[model samples]
Target: MADGAVSINMSAEECAIQALADRVMSQIADLFFAQHITPTPVQQQMLVSHVRAMALRSRTGEPLPEVEEALFEDISPDSMTLAQQVVDLFGNLPVEEAWLLSVHFEVAKNEG
Candidate 1:
């Protein structure tokens, strides 16, 4: 280890898992844009809230709260169609941009 730094290593499986997480986030962002969901301040707040709840559940393996449940609820009524748009848009993002957006999404998901 360096003077004040600790070294860390990730297994291939761990790396893949992280990559998959990034992809999901990027897809969500693309969906948000494609749906014309211009992230208003309120929507941004909701995004943050949803991400935080997801992170907590992910870490603790606990059920999401009812309040959080509403955030993930099918608000669009045509979520299946919107989801397809997201997938299509995500397919077109550059690799670097997609990865960067994924990081932002992950952070927002955890901290929003």
Candidate 2:
């Protein structure tokens, strides 16, 4: 550590996790453009952070927040579909991850 400075080191495992999050976000950004959804900078950041946290949860087997019982049943179909596609890109994430992302997409659209 330098004088008057604090240093934080990320492990190789952590680096890999962050890389996965970045890749997922990059692809999702392309998908958003293709789907004609313009994500604001705030939306992009929010979504990226959400994916990173979710990835950590899945990789660590941490309990994720439960989605509603209805889950995708009640959300906008387009957002749900978009979320499913994005989640698919993340590998074997729980379907609840998709539903959570669908809510994020739906909210981001309205807010953007």
Which numbered prediction scores highest in TM-score against the true structure?
Answer: 2
Q: Summarize candidate 1's per-residue lDDT along 9-71 as a digit string, tens digits.
A: 887755654555456556676766664545556656655454443433343456432333333
* Weakest ten-residue segment in model 2 by summed lDDT: 63-72
lDDT for predicted candidate 2 compared with the true structure: 0.80
In candidate 1, residue 64 scores what lDDT? Answer: 31
Candidate 2: segments with Cα more than 4 A from true spot: 71-74
TM-score of each: 0.38, 0.84
Q: Pick the candidate with the highest lDDT.
A: 2
Q: Candidate 1: RMSD over Cα atoms?
A: 10.4
Please give the CA lDDT of all the candidate structures. 0.45, 0.80
